[model samples]
Target: MKRTIKATFMAAMVGMSALGAEAADYKQNPFTLVYDGAIAKNEPGKVNIHPVTYRLNGLNIAANVYTPANYDPAKKYPAVVVAHPNGGVKEQVAGLYAQRLAEQGYITVAADAAYQGASEGQPRNVDKPANRIEDIHGMADFISQYAGVDQQRLGLLGICGGGGYSLAAAQTDKRFKALATLSMFNSGRVRRNGYVDSQLETILQRLQQASAARAQESAGGEVLYAGDANLTDEQIAKLPFALYRQGYEYYWKTYAHPNSTFKYTMSSLLDLMRFDATNQIELIDKPLLMIAGSKADSLYMSKEAFPKASGTQDKELFLLDGATHIETYWVPEYVDAAMGKLTTFYARTL
Candidate 1:
């Protein structure tokens, strides 16, 4: 078993290294907010995009809502709320998925979690699990009453860290008729266990550090952060895990955005240390679909969490063959595979 695990991990690492060496550069038009795949403008009488804001838990949340071609206010349309990945904003993969879903005749909304992206908050980059779950709920709340959305047909799609929060949110919200996730990264598990459970021995020490960071915050001392460093190519290649190494390549090199960052307040770990995405997961009685890359190192997270959702009989675990953890974010073929499955699942359920 140990040998198999080691080999699987090494294979994933080597695959990501090849990906990192590719010369693909992501360039965007700042004026139009266009992203990968040449997403066209929201021309009149065609599919349109709307930027919106609303107050949630006393904080102003920023979000982008997309409506299908020739949208009519008099007609009701099914809606999906998309949750962005950790260290990701609404303008990246979440927006891509939202735009695709809108093209399929569903009204979709993707939002930046409070304190992250263009949203309003203090002491930015505080990545608390509870705040993330609330962001999902807040998206549902706003979109349910939007111009032509049918509240009864509400659905959700969360990617990476957002996926874990979506699971936690859907466990009780019930407002979401269907729930889906792509390349789900269990944030709490990774934070507590250190990626692939390699830091088990340091758990107590990390928790102590987190506690001290909290104390510093309470005393108005200098703020402390974690995982907020720049890495060179050599440094990145030397990282122990493929996820972290490729993650740096993705966020820093290819899809770099000023607001998107990997740093988070160390004090936030107080809540994260105890949070588990699979805790009370059985409470999700709605239809569920969890998608991951067949060759992704993070695939184990989805596999582990899928069976714990015992309350729902309507569930599926899909793997996009030949794709890795980060490739599904922008790779056309993999994105198409994921979108095809999502379209079918949401159409059937919602």
Candidate 2:
């Protein structure tokens, strides 16, 4: 009986250990880099990450610039500016892609939006559409002047919500010689109509709530936040959508960072409701390449926006078969596939 009890105890301990490992799946690394393929330590002659800061619209913006191996400032090379997703920081997927592009011999940069991440801003988490688009433009401004970058060959790559804002930024910014978006997420559409348009009838009611939140802020009342609430492991498991479920696992569990949160100010919806990723798309007449997962529920956003870019004489939509939206953020096969296409697209255009 003693032996039997010992075996049972050992079994229970192993099970608990597995649970613990699973629980911390998305937790940050000791060095605090949360994305896969992150730079553990910068090596001088290898692909290196350089943290930078600059002033944009009176705000101090933090960014990470990745330089290719054997980089020479005197020799000009093509560059790509990667925009982070909504509620995402420069250290997340944006950094992942930047590092990858740098490995492919391009100078790449990923930056924190002004009001989020390491950037300085007041009334934090103000995620308006205009601000997001400006963040992309600001990245271009800095990278175009960075050492070793070829201003004439500047490229733009945006992931998720960043993809939408990148579209808007490229519309008027002819400086971007080529543009590509991965898992493009239309924030304005999702904010105004709800994910998958599930809350279409309630749009007016939600708009009213946003207005009230703004009014409360103006009156110096307690500030209200949206999407900042924390969730228990059990609650997260129960989330219905694959994007939310897998996203929670990726962003909150395995690759979590203290500076990253899923929050935005409730009042930002005032401007968001008036925005659309496809607005003025015709103004973007450069090369365009959009990629999304074939199985992604959010695939419609890319499909809807692709055709509207009619002004672009060259545009292509590439889908990663059998992959979901969030999977493209971290899954190796999906990322590799996307990167393969990106290398070809940028090589041809830049």
Candidate 3:
């Protein structure tokens, strides 16, 4: 139980994080997307997925832009920037939602964060809060310049760790007319304080370890990492938290993608420990919508950040009945429910 708790909690700070050994064949997938209902090929007069790349802070960012059916570069359209989860790539749930939103007649883009997935960066999987937040801003920067995107009618959607970072990004990025988060996970809070603050007593001990990791990196020694555990089916099933138990199945088995992994440089904790998603949340004056499963163990994250968004009178905390954290990622019913709310929210606000 102790080992399971440690392994699960370490991987649970973001969206759906887990160790995956097998890589899904991208050759079979033209766009290399692993989500269900993904576009296999582009066709005329139908929703299309365009694989694109752009520069962000000197790193190459890989992204997929979804255009609504009958999309015309000559015609204006609202756009949304979708940020992936902590260990997630652009082809997972982020792609799923981007495609879905495109179907609703909105242009959307889901991008791989720098240092993760296909995006270029050294010491891969460096999941720092600042980088993740900047990734959101970068996506907006790119999409707003796209052919038909209306800069004034832009929206933002962040999932899991991306959600937490979205909150931070939206606080100052007024370009986003509205913002939404699904199954939001406060990565900093979970990293420094532990799941539900379970490891509060070890705060100093962990800080010392993170400090050592930074020292090692500075000295040109071995790079240390966290949240990179390989577990068997039985071990995964034995995980106490549904967020991780199902997450393992989602990222490692069902929706497994080669670029996804629950690992980050240990030195990242130096910045993560002091960060908080809700630190200046009230600065977000745009309309906000935060959705989480009512039964989700991570629901508290959304609830905690919701009230702190006191700057927005148009904020809402909608709960999907009988849904769990991981379930909201792939479950059709929950996805549909979330999409409905998102469509309405963006339509009303954007």
Candidate 4:
């Protein structure tokens, strides 16, 4: 078991190295989007995509704003800010949901988180909770000022790890009137305790390694990273967790994007190890909707976090029967079902 774990980490590092060797051309696609049914070109009478960039904490955040068909800036419209999964770009699942919500007559914006995707940051792919939460707030800030947006009607949808951060952000940032999470993965819990508490015994050891990595950085030593891998089909299939196995196929295969990568600086674990999405979850007093696949190996995350949101009386937990964690990202039937719930939820709440 130890050997297998070591091999997995090594493979991830190899994959990250290869990914870093190539420069990501955000314009590779016509609209720089990788999802299916993405807009090839904007038309006058359809849900149109507008590529946008705005300053967030001195960093340029790359985002896409989708306007509903026949959308007139002269008229007010509800808006939703979609946050992508960890290691995901704005052009993947987030863009898909943004486009779908726009078709539902709501303006939606999806942005690449700082230090990941097309956004500006150093030591790329720094997966810190504070930064991730701030990205959501930044999205809300940008969208609130957009034409035709009703600030009072703002809603939020966070997928995977973003969902956890959204929970943290909405706790104190009450600008969001409604909040929702899909396949929420608690990055802090997983990092500190390992997936499903599998690494509970190594908590101190990992922290020591992170501390050493930070010390090395402070001394101008070689920078180290974690979570990079180049696993083969066999390795991926052998992964113990359904979330990791299917996540490999989704991010590295079917929905691959140049800007998306799993690696983060080893020192980031210092901050990540201490963060918890549910630490102050009760602060979220707004209406909340938490959705997850009944069969998802990671479903426990949402199940655990949902009940902690005691500040809101208006909350619901919806399950997608037979869907896995990754399937909820792109599977047609599951996506449709989730969109239905989201549309209805936003309409009623926002």
Best by TM-score: 3
Query: Which has the better TM-score: candidate 1, or candidate 2?
Result: 1
Per-candidate local distance difference test: 0.82, 0.81, 0.89, 0.84
Better of 1 and 3 by TM-score: 3
Question: What is the per-residue lDDT of model 3 for residues 253-317, given as tens digits with 9 covering 90 to 100?
Answer: 77888898887888999999999999999999999999999998889999999999999999999
Weakest ten-residue segment in model 3 by summed lDDT: 17-26
What TM-score does candidate 1 reach? 0.92
Query: lDDT for model 1, on a 0 to 1 scale?
Result: 0.82
Q: Mind giving the per-residue lDDT tens digits that candidate 2 earns over 189-298?
A: 87777677765887898789889999999999977776755666666556555677666666666656667777677798899877899998989999999999998878
lDDT of 4 by residue, 1-350 (tens): 55456334322211111111223234666887766677889999999999999999999999999999999999999999999887788888889899999999999999999998889998677778899999999999999999999999999999988898899999999899999999887888888887777779998998999999889988989777787667788877797777776666667766678888777888988998899999989999999999888988778899999899999999999999988787787778888999999989999999
Return the lDDT, model 1, position 319. Answer: 95
The predicted structure with the larger TM-score, 2 or 3, is 3
Q: Estimate, for each residue in 1-350, the C-alpha lDDT of model 1 and write its tens digit.
A: 33333222222321221254343334435323434753555687777888899999999999999999999989999999999888888877788899999999999999999999999998998889999999999999999999999999999999988898999999999999999999888888877776677757778988999999999999999778776666667766776666766666666666666777777788988888799999999999999999999988788999999999999999999999988888888788899999999999999999
Off by over 4 Å in 4: 1-28
The candidate that achieves the highest lDDT relative to the unseen native structure? 3
Candidate 4 minimal-lDDT segment of 10 residues = 12-21
CA lDDT of 201 in candidate 1? 79
Q: How accurate locally is residue 203 in candidate 1, as Cα lDDT from 0 to 100?
A: 84
